[model samples]
Target: MSEHLTIVEHPLVQHKLTLMREKSTSTASFRQLLREISLLLGYEALKDLPLTEIAIDTPLTEMRAPVLAGKKLALISILRAGNGLLDGILELAPAARVGFVGLYRDEATLKPVQYYCKVPADLADRPVLVVDPMLATGNSSAAAVDLLKERGAHDIRFLCLLAAPEGVERMRQAHPDVRIVTAALDEKLNDKGYIVPGLGDAGDRMFGTK
Candidate 1:
């Protein structure tokens, strides 16, 4: 990956990440941890969200409150595993619009092919955040972004639980303007295309299966 990619490495994020990496962690536990960590990461990811001041009651008196400003956000979950992180972000940004991009890998090409795509209104205006658990080779994630851009989403950001260096590098080269917010960028991808030292198959772990 390019040395230019920025990663959120807060201590709390690291501590939670360790528990998620443990082999003994059950699918249920893993899913719970993923939700918790995703929320934490989303907190940092959305720190720069524009906020407008509004008058509100503070029990004793009316005070100015900060509420999300401008157009509402669009949260796009990159299918299956991304749904795990999507749920937590929805809790944080309930009013945010939702979208989905389903990419199923082709057995022969070993490449992701879009099975389905549905986005919210005003993609040209809203700031869209795409969420997925793992970004390994970058082919699927980059393809997903391409589809979003084609649909008029100019401003985009990617949020992930973990990323492989190769994926990070590819994303940077493919789309340098789009910021990639990840918890950690691991070493490399193994022969079978799994991230080395990764928390196994994220979908399987979250869903409680092989």
Candidate 2:
């Protein structure tokens, strides 16, 4: 497995995370907190982005400066809950190319079925970061990665707000090469496939629906 998983434990992130977990937190606050947490999480996820030295001038002297290496980053949101994390990451990496992968859960099979997917061309050439809020069963996430791989995404990372152990294990088994970055690793999932103590259906919560 790639050593790409990093759990950010900053006080601010933890604090907001707590508020987001509360059953009483309003949808507006939940959305705002998600955005804030995404920025913090994104910061941790992009810490190792390649950097190259460039000749530049300071206020008083010319010097070599470091800048992001290679082509721009590509942020792909595994909609629609992924959009929550996508917003803040975009704020941090405004220039990064954006893409979307929409998958819906199949009630009978309990697997993710792709409904829509539109990614940038030449995925193998760009560093792609896939964002989602809850990595519950990891079925959708894994399927999304599979599609990306089919399209030639060699270097890809999965980012999420929360993850269940089962989901993590599933992803590890399915795609050991894909690194997973999340805010918290919750306990095992419930019989219903929901992460224990999870904030509950991310899409529903984020949109203030049932």
Candidate 3:
């Protein structure tokens, strides 16, 4: 286990998260708020991105400026819920490469079952940011990350809207190198393995499928 987690406490992120947590909030409002919050979280998640100074000619004068160091970032969405975060982050990092991993929870096993996966061939070359809205048991997140690692991804980060302590611990034990960034760390997971005080099923809430 390792200390590789960040809790974002921006006022805007907290405010929108509060709105999303309300049981009475509509699907449209929840989706919109999620988009807004993801933008903020994405900004925080990318704060420490490697940078390099580059010489460039500005309108005023020629000078060196700091720019992202490596190739374009790779954003991996963990199925349905991750899509919500993916869309919002894409609004900010339009040039970033995108990928998807479809992992459905098997009720009996309470583990992730990957039904779909496709990523850029250069995953090992660029920084990879994996997005999932909720990290409950962490089995799926861990499994997804394992798949990436198997594909040669080393520099990786996990981003989520909410996380439970148990899930965080699970990730810590499973993959210490991957840093986790979340908007809020909730108390615990419920009987059915949902984050306590979480915004219900993120996929259901965001898509009005509940």
Candidate 4:
């Protein structure tokens, strides 16, 4: 989590990502793979969560056991596609507070346009994880972080399925303190601001929409 970016190279994660990337993969299969891979990515993302020990009694003896410390995690999904990643992470951290930021790219400008936003209270007191499947242009991701900061979110992390170098650099420049975790970092983005060699539009694939 200290690094600006962490790529999850677990074999299971990579294998599932390959399946999800295939054009022939069905909507059902893609959605399932995303959920499956998201757990692995979430594992890497949450590895550095602070821990504290507390005394607990075992069947035979009592001992100090470690448990998560500090406030409950706040998970903010960056709209529709982010919801796909959100599901698996929720399964991983069932008690995490949930929020959403709705944004879409303006085709001509390639900038993010926000339409909706609703977040949990006391963001400043909790660690935040922003979920999104693609980090193509980084405009939306950066904008999402901007909104979170406005709401007093300081400790934040970003999780995604795929990232382009351009997007990574963009986030680095915009929010250097926020760590980014992803299943894979592909090549540069296409002219249309889509990650090249990416699994296509994640929202479309996951939802079987055009």
lDDT of each: 0.87, 0.89, 0.92, 0.95
Model 1, which residues run further than 4 Å from truth? 1-4, 57-64
| Stretches > 4 Å off in candidate 3 | none
Candidate 2 residue-wise lDDT, 1-210, digit = tens:
237456778899889989999999999999999999999999988877889999998999999999998888989999899999999999999999999999998867769988899998888888889999999999999999999999999888889999988889889998988889888899878877888888899889899989
Clashes of each: 0, 0, 0, 0
Q: Which candidate's TM-score is highest?
A: 4
Candidate 3 residue-wise lDDT at 207: 94
What are the root-mean-square deviations of the candidates from the true structure over C-alphas? 2.0, 1.4, 1.4, 1.2
lDDT per residue (tens digit) for residues 1-210 in model 4: 237999988999999999998999999999999999999999989998889999999999999999999999999999899999999999999999999999999999999999999999999999999999999999999999999999999999999999999999999999999999998999989889999899999999999999
* Clashes by residue pair, model 1: none
| Preferred candidate (lDDT higher): 1 or 3 | 3
Winner on TM-score between 3 and 4 is 4
Residue 107 shift from truth in candidate 3, angstroms: 1.3
Which tens-of-lDDT digit does each residue in 1-210 have in candidate 1? 333455888888888788998989988888888888888888877777888999998879999989888899999999889999999998889999999999966656658898999999789888889999899988889999999999999888899988998888788888887788888989998877778798898888899867
Segments in model 2 whose C-alpha atoms lie over 4 Å from true places: 1-4
Candidate 4: pairs in clash: none
Candidate order by lDDT, decreasing, is 4, 3, 2, 1
User: What tens-digit string does per-residue lDDT give for candidate 3 at 8-86?
Assistant: 9888888999999999999999999999899999998888789999999989999999988988999999999999999
